[model samples]
Target chain A: MMMEKLTVYADRMSQPSRAVLLFCRLNAIDFEEIKVDISKRQHLSSEFREVNPLQKVPAIVHGNFNLSESHAIIVYLNSAFPGIAEHWRAKINSAMDWHHSNLRQGTVSYVINTVLGPATGRPLNPNAAAEAEKVLISSLSNLEDIWLNGDGRFLLGGSQPSIADLSMVCELMQLEVLDEKDRSRILSPYKKVLQWIEDTRAATNPHFEEVHNILYRAKKKFEQQRSRVAETGTEPSNKIGGHSKM
Target chain B: MMMEKLTVYADRMSQPSRAVLLFCRLNAIDFEEIKVDISKRQHLSSEFREVNPLQKVPAIVHGNFNLSESHAIIVYLNSAFPGIAEHWRAKINSAMDWHHSNLRQGTVSYVINTVLGPATGRPLNPNAAAEAEKVLISSLSNLEDIWLNGDGRFLLGGSQPSIADLSMVCELMQLEVLDEKDRSRILSPYKKVLQWIEDTRAATNPHFEEVHNILYRAKKKFEQQRSRVAETGTEPSNKIGGHSKM
Candidate 1:
């Protein structure tokens, strides 16, 4: 059977988008990556809306069948494609579902409210950031104590990294944009989780680092902006200012 | 090979729990319903923690393998058992994932903050309730305009109801506990959504009603409480009052 070519619509800066992209590259799945520049508000355009009515990255067009939501897309890809292992599906599904309201929700809320909001013209929301930090800390503890209880490096004790690992590590990567001290304070306690993140990166490298370049670049720019504020003895502007666009 | 009996830990009051129970009953999958009453805080008990360390309702023990997250549980059940249609898997997976951040998040927040918070001794937050309403309305619009755009009933236009339909409709049913005028005002705008909800309920039949009886009973109690407040010219107590426990 001739399979329809897979085209992924993603913004590399978005965590789930990076997961999908990294998954495809790691599996050697033949695909096209159509960059959906979320930082530029391109995802909300009508053109992209035709692909995903939710107006979110990353969505996928597998021939005529269009699918959105990262977990769903990856699960479908795993089932539809060759070479990926099947044994990981159920546990992977559990981890991904838990991710939404737990890690993904907290990390996304924390990053956007505390930092990225300014880049996008949404002002800092200290109350929301604080609440998100609490949720993130609790979720990290759960990840370490519950999910990573086993000796294996990857989630659910899989020797090979699963889609769940990719998705979750991508979420944690959002913390990179935080102030170094703040990021350390939040993540330093989760020793096992940090080890698992490194393990996942090692397992799916090159592509993992490749997809995350956007985030790393943004992180550097954010740090530079913060240091400038410190040197100038001025509060950072509500916006990212004219120069440093994410 | 003989399969181990499935045991589901659920509270009927929870939207996702009802979805899981209704799915099992509709599919005639042999299972034991072990009620983990959230209102009574049984889900938080150390015993329940053995079933699901996350301490959330709607966990399942299928033989030795325990799974939490209703979407994962239902999808695993659909696969591990017979009688479920296979074609619905990808679309159903997409809908369930989309539900987490959109419909499920918004509806749960709106209900908890606006109504159910007090039942559990958590005071209502008018700000959160108002914010949740905005999200709920936007989600409903997306449901009407995007998901239910097809001629056939249910999400993604399947003739038979999918897990997605059951989960989403169960979430909407939370509104039943709100004041009648508020419920109508919130729901009436999306004519197609209301019809789709009915279609889902009809497709699931006697089981839907059987499981939703808990919600229906709670609805009646909330209404009576409201009427008493109106007649006596007293602000409805922040609590649901001692006599009416959900």
Candidate 2:
């Protein structure tokens, strides 16, 4: 039986979506990319709901099978495709599962509360930001002290990068939107985490950088907005401009 | 090479731990059970940290390999053990990944805020509980409308219960500690969700009840405590008694 072409519905601004996109490109898997602009609430539209009832981006359609959750999507692709079976292992699976509630939760919460919330016209929630920062610091500490403790540069000490590395590095990439001081203050304590992120990016290389271009654009736009606020000499409104087109 | 015996580190009071325990029992996988009582703060012990540096329950030791995260443990067990490969599938993987931020988060947050907080001498946060309730209601609606919409009794419409079913059902079981009024009010609108829970429970009976015996005991104790509070004419402390021994 011939396999149907795979379709990925994602938004690069969304971390997990970028992971899936980068993974496909890295593995040389042929697929179509359908951008779902979450900032515009496109993910909530009725049509997207048909693809994922949960109405989230980074969902996939292979033939009649539809699946959501980036970890699941990557795992399925690895299983369904060829030449990538070596990357899927028990340790990697453990790392991916740990990512959801730990690293992923912290980075997403911190970035959303501090940066994305105001950018989207939601008020900056100081209390929430403080709470999220604690989780972020603790999660980073775990990455430095535990996960990267092994001799291997990647998580669980594997010499080669795996799906876990891709997914997590994508998550940490959200910090790019933070101003230099805030980002450095939060990330500086974890030498290992910093090196691991660099190592993951180096491993994935061109595809990793290519998929993250959207975030880099957003980061640039965010910095420009901050400077404009500074120049106006008024009380900083804290809100940045809305999402840029991908 | 001879295979070494597996040791499961868990505490039944924890939802994911029970899921791991039930999966092992259901699959008839020979293993040793090592309880890590979270209520007593045993999971925070230095020794437990050696087993899982993240210091969470539902971890496993398979020979020299130590794995945490219930989803990972269940997946690993299914792959490593005999007679269980049929149960592992992409859809099930999707459901498990989705559970972390959806059903599992809502249930765990709501329970901790309203029931577990005061019981553990932590002050109640009505704001958090209210927020958690909204997420809980939304999650229940999703489970009913999307997951259980299919003809099959379990999630994603599978006839035989998968690890996703065990994990989610165990998470939902936390609501048993709530008073009847609150539990009914929260769960009533989702008819399909209610039925799915029953179907999952029935499909995994005997062992299900046996594993959940600790929760049943906790429920009875909670009810007795509520009656005492009512007789005393005190404002409902909103805290149930501390975790009962397994």
Candidate 3:
């Protein structure tokens, strides 16, 4: 029962891309990983436009059918492969709705401004990052109160991880780059959510770490830059010039 | 085979709220509609927060179950009800994903900036509106190039309208307040999408018009304000001053 090899256009640094990549690997859904380096602006090139004219990455091309948006791609994959055993369909649907403006907004944009900005020459806008942090804290609160209510290890209170869990946790992990005080100040309040992050990583195993390697690297670079600024009072600019490294 | 009565929290003027209202009515899903007027800041009240802590309109509470986000609410209803003939589930899923950033971002944000701002004392920012229009036009172009490529009358090429049609067309209709020239310039080229808008309206008929009645009224007011401003060169400040009407 071999599935057709699906072609996934992704950049590991992208949060949703990691979600899609991890989903495929975890589900044993065979896919050819096409590295679309967003840092190189590869996603915006004309060739990538053929796959996703939206010019965003984490898209998929299955035969002639092209799909973009990590959520839709995951939904398509869930149905395309029979019996993935995600029993919390109702809760999963709710979580997706919650994810877009909540988790997706809080982590993704915050990281782009605070963590990824310096690397891309858009020096971190602290005001924007602060607003994003507020959003993330509120989002985590919502997650704790609603999605992760039960004692289950996942958002859906299921024994197994659902698409919602994968999509959300992937974005949340990007907070790793922030100074410990800032990250923990927002995240530490949500004990259950933190535990679930660990649980999700555990359940997804090697693939989770595989997809998130780029984020981990970025986090290290960000911390190093932060400490350098702290020590020498020197500008953190010019450390990672050019978009190719993003 | 009567189902438990559903309770929907919505505001007529909110685009997604209209989508949810239209969805329920179109599907003949009987529900009690609870008015949560954003203009009055009713949604932000502690009481309303009990229902949806986000305090955004268009949440539903069915029995003990609560849900938020118009897209997810509709998707859940589609599954909950038996034999609802809105086929093209796959295409519908794709459209929802596409609708969020593309249609929702462009149309909804433009309407918010251009149309709603003045009524609330925020005044129109032409630059922002122009930027939003470009986004809307680009979004429409993408729709024409991709979703409307087939011979289908509706988005999924189905005879019956799906939630995607309902949600997207509702958002698109918010463009009515734009200057006729501006609106036409952006929308006129896309004959297929225009026809689909017509098709969705026809399919969702009475309910569509019923739900969008507030929008049409708002459009009328906008036009009157523009004409009055043109004639008298007076400030368009005194029209509707308070939250009760919004």
Highest lDDT model number = 1
TM-score list, all predictions? 0.94, 0.94, 0.86
Write the residue-wise lDDT of candidate 1 on A1-246 in tens digits. 128989999998888899899988988999999998976779999999999988999999998989998988988898789778765777778888999999988999999998898766677899889989998999999999988887788888888888888889999998999989999999999999999989988888888889888878988988988898889965555452345444
Q: Which candidate leads in TM-score? A: 1
Model 1 reproduces what portion of true contacts? 0.68
Candidate 3 structure quality by residue, lDDT tens digits, B1-246: 246668999999888998988878877888999999888889999999999877888999888888888888888888787767757565577678777766786786687787677767776777767767887888898788877776678775666776787888888888777777777888899998899989898877887788888877877877888899899997666535534443
Q: Candidate 2 DockQ category?
A: medium
Candidate 1 segments whose C-alpha is farther than 4 A from its true place: A1-3, A233-246, B1-3, B233-246
**DockQ of candidates 1 onward, in order?**
0.72, 0.75, 0.44
Candidate with more favorable, higher DockQ: 1 or 3: 1
Instruction: Give Cα-based local distance difference scores for all models.
Output: 0.87, 0.86, 0.80
lDDT of 3: 0.80
lDDT of 1 by residue, B1-246 (tens): 127989999998999899999989988888999999877779889999998988998999998989988988988898899767764777778888889988888898898897788655678788888888998999999999988987788788787788888889999998998878889999999999999988888888899899999888998887777788779965455453345444
Ranking of all predicted structures according to TM-score, beginning with the best and ending with the worst:
1, 2, 3
